[model samples]
Target: MNERRTAVPPLIVTQDNSFFFEGAAAGRLLIQRCADCGTLRHPPGPTCPQCRSFEWDTVESSRRGTLHSWTISHHPQDPAFEYPLAVGLLDLEEGTRLVADIAGVPHDELHIGMPLEVGFAEHAHGAVLPQLRAPGASRTEEGES
Candidate 1:
């Protein structure tokens, strides 16, 4: 029997941000750091905004962060996500903020400053990305939704 598969759009990986995806594929969360100014940035860029330096390096995150903000979405559903999806803005221990899907904790329990950690999950198209979870949550499980 022929099976139909839902395909998530492929990520547009560019030279500036390839490291981020590569890291996630390797079960790591890598952030770009400006070699000259020691500033950290997310959504990896070609040059550091703080110092406009082309020289940069990667830092492995502690994978721990506080929930700085969050929102739940319910409309315009996509095949890659579940309904009532919870997404969060996390303030990482290393001083950089990253946004990711929140899981393992109910929507009501999520609060500002609650501790969470980064975990990798395979999404549509088998792309690995970070998912935020409550501390001590299992990482071996596949992403929900």
Candidate 2:
């Protein structure tokens, strides 16, 4: 009999931006929201700059957004990444813009304002990185290849 081994999942840690990791593992996309004025924030800060409110809350994002900007890298910045990878800024429905890799779509098909959803990619080192893709797109067995 042959035995197959399953790799352990990545460990996500959060020293300051614990909300981001906490939400990811739970399959919920979360961003920082101001408790005082209800403004959404990215990069998860300790305070709301607009309202000067120290009180903040973590809210589940729509997991849906539009492509704000994008770039294709022919040269790999990190050796682990394959050539011709696309990275982009996704503007979430919650009003926060997130920067992550735009995957599972051809670069020629990318356009600003195209609706997208969140996806997760597990690295060789076992770290899970957030990725963006076209709406209704799936990483496996569906959508544009």
Best by lDDT: 1
> Which pairs clash in the backbone of model 1?
none
| Tens digits of lDDT, candidate 2, 1-145 | 1222335234445554887876765556888888999888888777788988989888887789999999998853554565688999998887889998887788899999999998766554545557897776644523444
Name the runs in model 2 displaced over 4 angstroms: 1-15, 123-125, 139-145
Clashing pairs in 2: none
State residue 17's C-alpha deviation in candidate 2, in Å: 0.5
TM-scores, in order shown?
0.89, 0.79
Model 1 ranges with Cα > 4 A deviation: 1-8, 139-145
Where's the lowest-lDDT run of ten residues in candidate 2? 1-10
Q: How many backbone clashes does candidate 1 have?
A: 0
Cα lDDT tens digits, model 1, 60-127, are 99899999999999976776788799999999999999998998799999999999999988877778
Who wins the TM-score comparison? 1
